[model samples]
Target: MQATLMIYNGTAAPDADVLRTGGVPLAPARTTWPMCGNTCGGPMQFFAHLPVDYGVLSVFVCQNDPGACDTHDPVSGANRVLLFPSAELVPVAVPEEGVTLLPAVSAITTAVVTLEPEEADEDGLPPDAYDLARGGWKWEPGELFGKQREVLGSLGGSPSCLGDDRLPECPSCSGVMEFAAHLEEGIDRRSAMNLGGDLGYVFVCRPCSQGAFLRD
Candidate 1:
């Protein structure tokens, strides 16, 4: 997969039938050796399955030995993000190499919802990507029957945490790594990943094909 920095606009949590950490893949994967962790030296655990404007995006992470992997380094081999054209997509079975599949619950159906587009300026200039993702969080919920929840569909830039300038540094070069994506707890209480109430931050050093995962 060509490495690119991307931010997808979706529900704060992942959606149904979407691949997630410890969840079985949707269809036959393209290959047997789906993803091998660069640092962990084994198959990486699936973390998310996202459908974007182009196609599907799959995210994986290696928590085999978190601290030992130096997850703060983008090329530490602890994490990976892949994008694929829907037509060419193939699903993979979970590797039976002693990898633990963390517990996840059934996906929640939040209900019908509509998202308000990010506001434009008097000149009709589109809002900045960072600003849109940061602000989109507040507009996600509404009173359904009585509970406040998000409607299904892309909400545009629902970044879990931003503006803290907590970007990680590359362990190899000591250079500042680039922010890549934000991972949240699953759509609700049932399917939430074991992030300990922290959002997962992904970073990458494209030239090195190395990635890192962090939580804050």
Candidate 2:
């Protein structure tokens, strides 16, 4: 999972706690990591601490060859890792470690860059290296939805949460609908496994069968 949760300046912004009327939370504005220069062989540059596991905004420099100085290679510098907010200052060897740990979430004024959503699967990298947390939430994106496998969760077991954010409304009747129930199996996106217990909600309107999938 990639580190999608970002820590932007949360001082007075509504990001503090402004919930949408329907109960879905608005995406927060956050300051992502920036591309600070590289460390000199003699003197190293230190990044501040971070809040949680975070991905690199951009990949520059060659971790494989510290002296390569070319920011466009697939060497160690071609990749990055999540940084804990309380790590001590450590010198990073690009080929050996593409990332260095910091003490706190990067300050509010850091620049925002984009990184490849997924890291190349490594032999021993932890699962979180590619898993991005959305506000402390661990959810697989909708990518792995078609694989068939075993079942689990309320996915198809009991009832569906009307909280899904994409339910459709009926144009014919003006009525409220909710996810009343779900199937008994769940479906994961990548594995094609029947992650059983996929919950299906029932939505029925007072005026008509305008009920449909609810918003998450």
Best by lDDT: 1
**Candidate 2 residue lDDT tens string, 1-216:** 222222233222211122000111122133233232333322111211122222111111122233433222212122221222232323232223333221122113222222345543576533332122211232246654322222111111112223333343444553334323221121223211121222223233433523232112
Q: What does candidate 1's lDDT look like per residue over 89-208, in tens digits?
A: 454656777443445533322222333555777887655544333334345456224211221122224334344456656666766765555555555564455455555665555555
TM-score of each: 0.52, 0.19
Task: Identify the runs in model 1 with alpha carbons over 4 angstroms from their true place.
Answer: 1-22, 26-29, 32-39, 105-181, 187-190, 202-214
Q: What lDDT score belongs to each candidate, Candidate 1 first?
A: 0.48, 0.25
lDDT over C-alpha atoms for residue 93 of model 1: 59
**Candidate 2 C-alpha error for residue 74, in Å:** 43
Each candidate: RMSD = 8.4, 23.1
Candidate 1 matches the true fold with a TM-score of: 0.52
